[model samples]
Target chain A: MSKPAIAIDMGGTRIKIGIVKDNVILVSASIDADSGNGLRNRLPDIEKIVKDLMNGQKLTPEDIAGLGIASPGIIDTNEKKILSIDKKFGDAPEIDMEEWCQQAFGLSFCIENDARAALLGEWKYGKAKNYDNAVLMTLGTGVGSAAVMEGHLLRGKHFTAGILGGHFIINYKGETCNCGNKGCVETEASTWKLPSIAKEYSSFSDTKIAHVSPIDYELIFKLAGEGDFAAMEIRDQSLQAWAACAINLIHAYDPEILVLTGGIMASSSYIIPYIRQQVENHAWTPWGKVKIEEAEFPASAALYGMAYLVNSVG
Target chain B: MSKPAIAIDMGGTRIKIGIVKDNVILVSASIDADSGNGLRNRLPDIEKIVKDLMNGQKLTPEDIAGLGIASPGIIDTNEKKILSIDKKFGDAPEIDMEEWCQQAFGLSFCIENDARAALLGEWKYGKAKNYDNAVLMTLGTGVGSAAVMEGHLLRGKHFTAGILGGHFIINYKGETCNCGNKGCVETEASTWKLPSIAKEYSSFSDTKIAHVSPIDYELIFKLAGEGDFAAMEIRDQSLQAWAACAINLIHAYDPEILVLTGGIMASSSYIIPYIRQQVENHAWTPWGKVKIEEAEFPASAALYGMAYLVNSVG
Candidate 1:
């Protein structure tokens, strides 16, 4: 059994705060993120939410072991500091998270990249358990990943190892990515890029998919199921791009199991079979087949990861 | 001072054997490979060459610590046996290398992938020295690679981790790779794929490049330098593909240094600058720039790596 810890999963649009123990989130709350304004403005709200959640559980800071944060972007996990932030949490690099934790709760705390944190959670307590070599592919707004080789997380000098799967160039002649690379998996198939990808298809203007407000994977899958040509084309292309990304991860990390998570995994029924077949036919693993599985705690894996990190690291 | 060690680098066309000490090849020999007949038939020849090479050095098997082999395939280094082989070395998986080494020389031995051996050689004593996080991209018949993360080789469960950089899907919509994946860096720009890629160009037949027998990068670069339009186009695409692969490596491994080697590196004068600029402009390394450098021991890095492994490990 592990002591309770407060976990913060800071995302682009929402900040999920929870009180976690062992492998479960006991109580949780979510707050809207004004990410464009920066993380500095949200510090007070996060602190208050954490306090209220603990109070509702009849707990105090003294009852908790520590706090852990799962934030987007590169992080110096050893230093417990945000190294660089992307579109979300713009001011995270400037804020001293450790100092804030010390002032707010007088507790020890740690931080890790959200993707890595989610992987840690899954690897430690979810689908990837018992496997020394594993990879986590979290598909949502963008593809996120982490690799564990021989039971060790691959954190390179800059702590960016194995976390940039979305940015890998999967199409040299394709569109430019926000990362300034050409034809990234994210650029070709991510939710944020789907509308544009669909619009570029010649038949898109003649289809119902083009008229949908904020086109997403669910709508695409639905329309594709109904035999809409443009939707099916976009959906099939996206699936291939994602399958390619999966194979890339399989080759790059050489993992025995690849754990898939994130919001997009809600449609795992349609995605898993396609990806598994592609990997079976394509990956060059001679040892045996790579097991592909869904994450057990998709929505809260990062929180459990924070709990595991906060409790285990010190 | 280190004791002498025997090292063997097995390739498709040639087998290089060497007696090494103190990071240098004291004596060496090479033999043509009848790979189609399998590695078993070549074993007696390898034993004879190694013994003769030692005799020339006035040394015996008793004077060496151990022997190490750098073979092209997935290897079980712990077991000192090949796990799986590619186009070359067909019967490797069936051969008992450890038993052969014991019977031939009565010495202990280890085996590793050829690309990883080169990286270990570079990381331990060559250009990648002092960098705990490094990557080696050896561009030859195919783009071979190996990665060192935090001073540990990234050999995953299948012993295939980090050595498949060429197989990474850099173009999801591109040509199919021999490995069955589509748009691999190798499929897009490797030496084996260069002729087909060049012939696909609309103006290939009109250019002098189309007249060359067994077309390779050297001729492509030379013709491009002479302002041949088709050559220039092929050269540029290959450069971009290689560059994309470089960025993919930097992102995947998060290395501080990337050491480029292999036969293709003879044109590093032209290849280096192009890859460096692409990595600088596109890699999402917020920590700083990843230093791209040439391999220190281009032709014999694997031999030195075997020496290091044999000498360092108990």
Candidate 2:
């Protein structure tokens, strides 16, 4: 039997940690990242969670093969350190993650960008297992993406190639993005930007959505289902933005399959068919239609991917 | 000394044939592609041009190592055949290019997309020679692009990945492209679309561009220099479109250098500075700025690339 590995997925708002073996999570736990407190201050919580999970599983440090971490932002996998944390954990890049793992767990550790880890998880244990060329679009606080081309993960000179699909300019003359680009898909339609985008709609004052605070895709979808014009307009525009993003990924990476993930996919019944129609009508794929599917592992994709990475490196 | 190779660049309107050795062209010839006449009918002319170029160089079939052909379409290089012609050459996909070369010149043959060939040419013998990760954007009748990543030419599953950079949608709610996408960079500002785009400009009737027939970039730039308001508006729009394309390429390919080519670059004094500014201000390159430079070979990049391809394969 293969030994179990400890996996950690560090997101902007939460940290998910698990003990995984043979693609199965034995025990998992989630804690608020409390990122405003910085990652260094949260390191002790992560350690305690990992230890609790191992103890619950009746396993010790020697019983585990290694530790794997997936975090947002540019990661230097070779050094097992975060290179730049956009806004999530400001002090993450300065934290010596590999040294922390060695001293706390007494095991080897590997770290990769969260999006790339999600792609690896999908490739290894999900819908993309059958595909040699595939792309993943994760719609959450921001739009994150990763690609596998001809069976090799596309890591460019700076390890930023496939990870920036969210940043592709879908609207050349539109709003400016925090990434400094104008009219990125993330800027036009993402969870973090959804509230402001909703407020700016021309029909906002006359519709039910105006009364809703903490505007998100869930509320928009619910309101649109009730025939709210402003909500419907915002929903349709968001779908178009995502569909445009899908076509852009198809053109940029030439993938055989596009796997959609993240919190927004809860409405896949409406989102999937709409995006499918748009891509089929707009993408210039000469070979055949690229398969569009919802991602299988939603919450634990990075954890599963971390397990794969740790095992492969070990 | 290396044996000479016959190189052919098949464009929509013309065919350029040359005898090349050691990255240098010995002799060359050109003929109207007369694509409306069909590619099958022009195969004989292509053969004759190759023969004449070989003769002018005092070389025979035995002096050549092989033949390489570059065409503007999706190409199956393994089969040495064009896969899709996209209106440029209606009958090209059905023609047996390998059989023609074998019977007419007694040489082994290879074919690649024109844009990919140009990228290879630039990588082998131009400004990108020193960089392993580079992208080439050729701004002409249409925007054509190709990429090299980690020292390998990126040919995705369907051989369309790197070649479709021009087709990336920069405007989600913009015009529909002939390729089925809406608001592609090619649709927004390529040479073929310039007239229609200029005609729709708000200031068209009030400026000199309205009186110009067969509107091309040269006329627009000349009039813009003379302070034609419509011409200046159109020029700035076109520049923004091209600049957006540069940023899109940077986000997609993650290259160290961006090599610009094609006929529209004749106004590089205006274009280079504008695009460089946009890229520097907007591109999210955490490592460093991606260098933007003009292609070294303009008219004969594909021919030089063909020579390199033939020599490498031989």
lDDT of each residue in B1-314, candidate 2, tens digit only: 56788999988778898888756888888899898878999988888878877777788777898999989978888878788766778899888988988999899899999989998989988989989999999999889999999999988999888998889999999999868789999898988899999989887788888887989998989999998888888889889989988998898889999999988989888898899899999988878889999889988888988888888887
Name the top DockQ candidate: 2
Instruction: List clashing residue pairs in candidate 1.
Output: A170-B170
* lDDT by residue (tens digit), candidate 1, B146-241: 999888888888898889999999888877888777889999898888889888999887999878888999999999999999989988989999
Q: Which pairs clash inside model 2? A: none
**Candidate maximizing lDDT:** 1
Q: Write model 1 residue lDDT over A38-66, tens digit each, in one string.
A: 99999999999998998999998889989
Off by over 4 Å in 2: none
Lowest lDDT block of 10, candidate 2 chain A:
A78-87
In candidate 2, how many Å is residue A64 off? Answer: 1.9
Give TM-scores of chain A for all candidates.
0.97, 0.97
